[model samples]
Target: MKRILGLSLLAVLTLASCKKNEAAETSTATTTTEQKDPFADDRVVKQSDLVSEAKNHAETTLALSEPDFNFGKIKKGDVVEHVYEVTNTGKNPLIISAVKPGCGCTAPDYTKDPIMPGQKGQITLKFDSTNFDGIVYKSAEVYANVAQVPIEIRFSADIQP
Candidate 1:
């Protein structure tokens, strides 16, 4: 009976030791796999190449009359509006894809049609200062088929309580 008990304990110890070795091997394998580069795909494009492509495709230019506007000392809950004139200075027609406001409190309106070369357009921005106080600054990004794809227009105000 004593011999049988000793043999059973040896078998349990061997199985436990085998499991520990298997766990250690798995951890080492995981570490090696993580150390390998994950982005091994062959279709990665360089940023410089993309920039060059953009430069080649950019055939139009967008000119803004006023890039910034300042509204002095306005009461809270006031809505201010301003218009910015945009012109196509290049030989090709200027196509404005989107006019996006930086925040939800600002609204922007613009013509959806393309602005021909030597033609003009307007972007109207309305800022709502409802629940806001002190100095506030906001911006709108204009996406167009110009040399500079995204043009930033900024507006600021001093809100009084």
Candidate 2:
């Protein structure tokens, strides 16, 4: 009867040890498997050949014809357009790389060619008043090689039904 009791205790200890080993194996498997990010892209981009190490960093100045304009009143759904001149006021050539509109309702078009010193370029701003009412003000950013900070163009309108 004593022998039978001792064997029962040993069986319980063996089962518990097996369970601990199984748990450890499961934890190690999970750690070894690496998780991938769902939002990461595999695409890569290289620098363009047009980029050079010896490119000029000479600073310059820009003279905007109309830094700001005010349209007293405009009808709803009306499209307004304006042209502003940009003159290079410094020694180096002026390169207008891009014009970023401050709002989605505004669109911009500018001269792509570089302007020599004392020469000028044009920037056209088109504004749509479809979903606006009352006093609406908009602006755009002019990106050029002249200055580190881009200059701003501002315009306002009072929308009427």
Candidate 3:
């Protein structure tokens, strides 16, 4: 036929010149990866530097208006009592200092002073459970100032073999 229409028009001009050299190498690799952002303005994060880092973290935070304290049940050789209430909501002055008891049948008392700022305090936990048995759970460990975070208090009971 005219040499097969000149080899089918040279195979459609070699697939349209390889699709225009693969679309100019995919538009020059998407314009050089959108013009490389070297650190892109150091990753902008400034709301006045997060309000001066929340005013230097509210001047060395010392919060604890409520961590948790619940003593709901009591029976076995009953003597249980609980007070637990505290506040100093950070801005300084809540020096709880100490209050520990995880054993020894659990007993603790608090407030020796130094709770100013928004002030409020009280921490008393006394559980005797008569040498424990069965569901008796308890824990108390409050040490503060700049809040190191460890003031959990819980209690449960069910001892009556």
Q: What TM-score, over all chains together, does every model reach?
A: 0.63, 0.64, 0.25
Give each model's clash number. 0, 0, 0
Candidate 2 local distance difference test against the native? 0.72
Sort all candidates by lDDT, best to worst: 1, 2, 3
lDDT of each: 0.74, 0.72, 0.59
Clashing pairs in 3: none
Tens digit per residue, CA lDDT, model 3, 11-94: 999999999999997775433222112212323332233333234422333444445544545556777767777877667666
* Candidate 1: Cα lDDT at 15: 99
Candidate 1 off by > 4 Å: 1-58
Q: Name the regions of candidate 3 deviating beyond 4 angstroms.
A: 1-76, 82-100, 107-116, 132-140, 146-161
Candidate closer to the true structure by TM-score (higher is better), 1 or 3: 1
lDDT of 1 by residue, 27-111 (tens): 6543322111121222433333433444554478878999999999999999998999999899887776556566667777876
Q: lDDT tens string, model 2, 115-161?
A: 88999999988888999999998887666765444577999999999
Angstrom error of the Cα, residue 56, model 2: value is 6.4
